[model samples]
Target: MPAGLTVALVAGEASGDQLGAGLVRELRRQVPGVRCVGIAGPAMQAAGCEPWWEADELAVMGLFEIVRDLPRLLRLRRALIARLLAARPAVFIGIDAPDFNLGVEKTLRAAGITTVHYVSPSVWAWREGRIRTIRKAVDRMLCVLPFEEAFYARHGVDARFVGHPLADELAPGGDAAAARRELALPPEGPVLAILPGSRRGEIERMGAPYAETIAWLAARLPTLACVLPVARPALLAPLQAALSAAGVDASRCRLVEGQARSALVAADAALVTSGTASLESALLGCPLVVAYRASALSLALVRGLRLIRIRHFALPNLLTPTPVVPEFLQAEVTAARLGPALERLLTDPAARATQQEEFGKLHALLRCDASRRAAEAVAALLPGYRAPNEP
Candidate 1:
């Protein structure tokens, strides 16, 4: 490794922060004293990446939300691009946040710096046409899912399936009793994990329905315990307000800060939002009901334009050949539907076992030591680079 080797990165949310942290650790191991810099979070910062801007600044979601924050985002991108250009690192890696990162990568790549996108966007689903833009922007795409490599291949893009880091971080079927003890939850009752989302917009739209579902379920099972994991400190007050308005029993529900995986481990079942949280619940072997609600205009455009390509929205469902979990979207995300779906998981042994079995298979498929593989892929892009194990 060179004395002044540097790698640039940008991770937009908590999940991406986790991914970025893993990638940074592996890169540091492969090349000692490698300098990592760009937009980062606490996890990535702890892993040794110097942040040019915090990841939270780029956390806006949905079409309307992005529009509202566009001017500020553009300014941030322009400044970041100029700084990165001056640094002239070995390679630039964009962890996730395709909308923001891809543009940054495209500009940097045009200036003769190599660019890599860590997570493949949902081109395999809706917005398949974005492949054209991605082709010009990314030198390589590091995919977490197996099928994504082939999808990019057909479009004449260079891609590699690096597996998912979460699959490697978490084991299949975690110890519920141990996790319950650590979280101070009831040791001998059916526990349910509720994860609305990591973003403010997501909780704003889904919190009411999720709170109502908890209230509905509490009425049925006297011994039912609930654990809700708040992704960020900013979301705590709003989530609490929603639960209070829905008349959910504050005594039975415990709100933990940022230990979502632990909350899922302690839970027998979960009501998870339809993105990374749904995937995390499945990986932890917790039976779950997946639900999502977005802005009215965004939902309308997706539905009216017929932009969605797949029948299933949840990551667990998309990963499997057949959908194993129930999902409620938009208007379908109601207490009436979500409550019953979760109830089945809690009460029916067969239903719980079925989902768990499928989850186990998916977990095995994705546990490919992803961080090392992603590091190797990034290493391949640098001039005169060689793996430590190689001759």
Candidate 2:
């Protein structure tokens, strides 16, 4: 449509990288020779994004973690702002990394550059005050969840729900028997998928509790097998140490690298750290017990500030009218709590079917060709932009 049109993007973590990559591919298809540049990971780089900085540089988690790296992050943001302002791209899309990208978006928007935020921060759940900053920062807020569009509209922000890429990528009711065969586990017995989390901080907090949960479940079910999927190779050492400390038998548990979806598909139930993985587990037709423990100081700050607004933390629960999945947070995220919840899902057909039924409905609501919709929303922000099929 336009010669050498450039779209600037910043994706802070692996999930955002994936979202950015899909958006890049779709944007390229719509506008030939569109150049994408910003902080990107391998996926985005492979999708033809020229990275000014790697996405991992901004992948810090937790309040303490971000505070620890604040100076370096601030420097990176300033430099990125300067670069994007100078380059003057047709549109600047902040994929995720709201803390970093929101400031960048605000600055760039102030400079008259069209700005869009791809994945909304949890303003609807916590810190609703951020709506003021979001209104200033984003020309259009492209949400991945359906409910988020209405939330933003009530606040007078220009927002659109483009649906979720994961819904488009993963089919409902995944083949458990086939996935178990692929993972080399017995196709008959009850298998449990344990996804601690992708971040090191998450693993550090969740590893022990997850290991204990495995031990608890294994004691109750003699035929139980556990599949622990490490989101990255770096997490293996810590995960192994945790399992060892809990005295979980090595023979009963198998650790695979980067096959979270397959692990979820293979298992009867999952003990998932409350984040995107929990949603993944649900989407793959696996019932899950969601658990999470934030750093003490982070929890203290959130509590002191009264930042948290919602009753449910799990994505599947938040998406639906009522809580479809059980969630345990803070000190409640222990073997005692997670064990029984997972046990019910593993043993009771009714509980599993109930969650699975809700998951199927949720999947249908979100399977909206997300990347293409996001690309269209982004393109609409560009000057004199028109759809390819527009007459």
**lDDT by candidate, in order shown:** 0.91, 0.91
Error of model 2, residue 260, in angstroms: 0.5
Clashing pairs in 2: none
Residue ranges of candidate 2 with Cα displaced over 4 Å: none
Model 2: what TM-score? Answer: 0.98
TM-score of each: 0.97, 0.98
lDDT, candidate 2, at 240: 98
lDDT tens digits, residues 200-235, model 1?
Answer: 888899999999999999999889999999988999
Query: Whole-model lDDT, candidate 2?
Result: 0.91
Error of 1 at 151 (Å): 0.4
Task: Score candidate 1 by TM-score against the native.
Answer: 0.97
**Positional deviation of residue 239's Cα in model 2 after best superposition, in angstroms:** 1.2
State which candidate has the highest TM-score: 2
- Which tens-of-lDDT digit does each residue in 109-183 have in candidate 2? 999999999999999999899999999999999999998999999999999999999999987667888899888
